[model samples]
Target chain A: MTTLVLVSHPQLADSTSQQFLKESLPDDDIIWEHIESLSSLDVAQEQAQLRRADRIILQFPLYWYAAPAGLKQWEDTVLTRTFVYGDHRYPLADKELGIVVTTGMPRQAFQRGGAEGVTLDAALAPLAALAHRAQMRWLPVFPIYQFGYLEEPEKLQLVVDYQRYLTQPQPDSLANRQDWFAQRLDGMVARLAEDQRTTGRLIASVFEQNREQIDQLHDTLAMIKEQDDD
Target chain B: MTEQSQWLSQQIDQLAAQQEKFTDRAFWLALKQVVAEQDRRSEQLGGEVDGRTWRPDRW
Candidate 1:
């Protein structure tokens, strides 16, 4: 599936996190647009790019707990009612809207009892509302906290995870995340030597057990929804 | 096994340990706590800096 990543960091060239994330993304099947680099906004061209994408990611560093003015302007200028909302002609319907946000503050600081006194989800509520208004599926927020301080190994892991977060199919649910980890474990197991196969088997067994619990949780959630419908 | 494979194994082991204590309600809460603690010490050490004049382009 084609993905459109609209990078909105005003100083993207200097952002360690954004630069690393850009480098990590696969060159094929993904279109990268630097919103701040646009000297003049071309509405039709922007809409055309959105039309071609199956998923649209708004990547930005958190500025005063919201996106920078550049991204906000793009939304106001491009996502017009005729294209996004009214008249039963939602061009973005069935597409996914994802946000990739970075913060200099620690992750804990954005929670209810934390220093920020609000969760990241609450902070980015406007973006989620925008996705809802446009009839798009809102994916989970991908947060990179304190990017400047991360070590090499953590940065490497972030790169891999960020790539998967952008490209992975299905909504961000516990079950889906579990399945992704299980799939990775399976691949690792397959590459192990015969002598190391025992460890692989143990890990697989653990994963299978966890999968059962996740499945149970999914089923319970579905049953609750069914009851609500009835 | 390769270095990457070894790291994968370690991660699998950690996941297994986590699964044993898993509960939907507590999982999210625990995750939030862990994230909060990651940079707490560093932040405390540095204190809060004034960001009013901090331009993204300048940084």
Candidate 2:
């Protein structure tokens, strides 16, 4: 199937890692839909692109353990309920989705037991769910790990490596790709969307719980702010 | 479980506040599944994939 890679790297021209990765990907079967070139995309066009592809990959560089702020903004603007959910099926449903993020640290910096001890997966967990809600298949991630370990000249390999990872699918291949955790949403999206019947039970349990807790926190924060105002 | 719930909630709050985005239950449910599967897959294969052998199953 054809793939649409929605790249969201800031200053992609200056990013050697992204450049190398893009260069590595075979032009056939992969369409690099650079969000940068799109400049400012409208939801209609974004939705159209999502509808057109069998797979959609988010390509960007990580900032503070997540995608640049622009990506969060991208999702907020593009993934609205009317087009992404509700009675009308989102353009992303059943379409494979994944990520490729370049970072500026060693892989050891992001993990449960490593230097930073905060897993990249944990950091990007929200994006994972968002992909799921959109009904896209969450493919494996392509993370350019230990980015600080490489010299500028060596970074092209990291980009090329990520491009190669996007070409493949399957749980095992996902784990071994060049950029670990760059793709943080694929597994869940695939599991949830690939099977719809069980999704209901999952929603009631996990989905409802997240909402409840989040609401509680917001309510608490609001009250505290009011107290401070008082 | 309470602590986990609280932490999860906090993350949601941070994202929503910073982004002005609503966190849908559907998104959370979908994300929960992704976390579960990512954990499972890592347990099973421990980071290894043959680049030549992957394909996208129709969305």
TM-score of each: 0.63, 0.54
Q: Please list the residue runs of candidate 2 whose C-alpha ends up more than 4 Å from where it truly belongs after superposition.
A: A148-161, A172-230, B1-59
| lDDT of candidate 2 over A1-230, digit per residue (tens) | 67788788768798766666665564347777677676577888777777777877887887877888777788888877787787665667787777777777787788877876787778778888888787677766667765557774345334334544565454544333312323322332343333442443443355444434444544555665575476
Scanning candidate 2 chain A in windows of ten residues, the lowest lDDT window is A176-185
lDDT of the candidates, in the order given: 0.71, 0.58
Clash pairs detected, candidate 1: A108-B36
Model 1 over residues A1-230: C-alpha lDDT tens digits? 89999999888788878887877784348999999999999999999999999999999999999999999999999988888877788889889999999998999899988988888899999999988988899998999999889975566467556766777677655445555555555655555566566755675664565456445544555665575476
Report the Cα lDDT for residue B7, model 1. 54
| Model 1 chain B poorest 10 in a row by lDDT | B20-29
Which parts of model 1 have CA positions greater than 4 angstroms off? A172-230, B1-59
Clashes in predicted model 2: 18
